[model samples]
Target: MEAEYLRHGVPLADYQLTKADHRRQREAVQVHEWVQRQLAEAPPWSDERWEEMRQLLGSPTPPWELQRWQLRLYCGHVIEATRNRNSPRPDGGVCDKKRCPDCGLDPAVIVAFEPLGPAAEPPAESHSLRSSRSTRQPPADRRSKAELVAENNALRAELEVLRDQA
Candidate 1:
């Protein structure tokens, strides 16, 4: 089944897939390294921000669900694989078969994906201050994309200022 193939790679022989088919399938599920890098560099998730997102989605428990929504906010599809954590790919990455639940979106345009940093680490005073500032805003779901982007830019700027002050 296509779903099974996407969630967990099938043996080429079993599926009668050529190498090219496998390659194409892999590419379909691939998330570029830059996307991962950008996410890695983004600020960690603040407790309030995390809670807010949880509430927005009505608290989906599975990691993939939230991750899928996050990717949608950035790129309009689930570019990254998050399902089946215990089973990784042969290369030690996430299994591509576990990615994007079928919105059938093309890979995200790199330029379209914006990083909204949230604090994952223990907040420095400045970071806490930043969180306090964000707490005043309307909920994320209600905000326009432009507004969110602008706010993110402003937060990044504020963080730079705080870093310089330290």
Candidate 2:
């Protein structure tokens, strides 16, 4: 049956298709119908032309559902193939800048670049001390302690001088 043929011909399982796939399939069928109508309306064409049209309709190809599936497969393959190829080196954490290691793809083929920096390293104890010191504030009660101390010492010295005079 036609349904059986369509089911069998799909590269992926029927359940795997997303809603987008269904929409694409519907659009493809519409386009196919339009093409068929256009071909029918045109004046008698040569055998070669007819054959070409037939080929367009018959192959594992087109009518939208197949094209969408093919595109999905192609995209997935490219992503997986390039992922490892473009991965950064183990020692430096930097990916090879010149070429892909796995596929030998040119630098231009990679859409994004990721820089690998040094691996995790703990901060020194001194670093935490510096941070804490920078954030500390003086107690509210001792806010003017330095100035008060200086004033008290001056007053005491003056008293001692006055008492000496007495």
Candidate 3:
């Protein structure tokens, strides 16, 4: 349900959610904007960077997932109301009721997060380049994060040089 909202980008009022859901969706939108800004300015240096950024931030899922996850966490509990519109309450914790097969809510719930945890995005990714075992190219994953940044800068310089040459 939340995914449909996040994926669609339609206004929250379209979802027919209860008042609490509307508030939660609004909060999610804020989170979504912040996450997008982070994504745009993240390391600016690798395919794996966004994943790493996400790990530092909190979620590997899309902005909407985190938004919905946060909403569910906040709602704690929501009761079945008219026409499948669930009325979530701040108290009582609807987590148990969340188990219904048709409900489709997040399975596990977490409270807090640590700063420098595991890699948000794994290193095994291609940065717009096809993966090849060429000796001229070493996988960016093998290089330290510092090395990758330096390499990126060098590549940018080389690109400028090529453009001037052309």
Candidate 4:
């Protein structure tokens, strides 16, 4: 039987009675074709562009996108203040005294930092699990497994009857 099974390449599962095992198989030829397609479509990153990005980052190390977004916000405020002549600069260039030059506003004006801070820490795995647990409905409060099973059976019977009537 084993020799015949190997010789015919018959799946063993067909001979056995069991629950479904869902698994996907891909051809080697198809995998090779996908690799070729990916290589052809993807563009290589240039060293010059990388260097420019590093300079924009202000340090050799690059900060995360969130930090970059925060810095962008600050720079935008600084740009707006300077353009409007409201920047707090002693020479009226922008606030040199850490306050708005025109309006004497401190927090209202933006101050540019020479170096942007490092990126915030990535969220912990536990936090996500906890959040998901909190958001989900708890298991039904009904008493006894027998009662729940009875209820489920009743519902199924009702559904089957409705389908037959329809």
Using all chains and alpha carbons, the TM-scores for the candidates as numbered come to: 0.28, 0.23, 0.22, 0.18
Model 3, total clashes: 4
* Candidate 2 lDDT, 48-114, residue by residue in tens: 9989999888864222221111112211122212222122321123321223344543331222222
**Candidate 2, superposed: residue stretches over 4 Å from native:** 1-11, 47-166
Worst 10 residues of 3 by lDDT: 110-119
lDDT of 1 at 162: 100
Ranking by TM-score: 1, 2, 3, 4
Candidate 3 ranges with C-alpha deviation above 4 Å: 1-16, 47-166
Give the per-residue lDDT of model 3 (tens digit) for 54-146: 788884333211222212222233222111112122112332223223344333121111111121322444422334434356655697889
* Candidate 1 residue lDDT tens string, 1-166: 0121112222222333346545655464465555677899999999999989988989434442121112221123323333322222221243223233555434422111112222133337755776788778777569788989999999999999999999
Superposition TM-score, candidate 2 onto the true structure: 0.23
Full candidate order by lDDT, most accurate first: 1, 2, 3, 4
- Best of the two (1, 2) by lDDT: 1
Q: After superposition, how far is residue 146 of candidate 4 from its true place, in Å?
A: 20
Task: Tell me the whole-model lDDT of each prediction, alpha carbons only.
Answer: 0.42, 0.41, 0.38, 0.38
Q: Write the per-residue lDDT of candidate 4 for residues 1-166, one digit (tens) a residue.
A: 0011111112222232212211111232345468779989989779998889888878442222222111111112321111111212212342322333445433232222222222443357655776788799757785688988999999999999999999
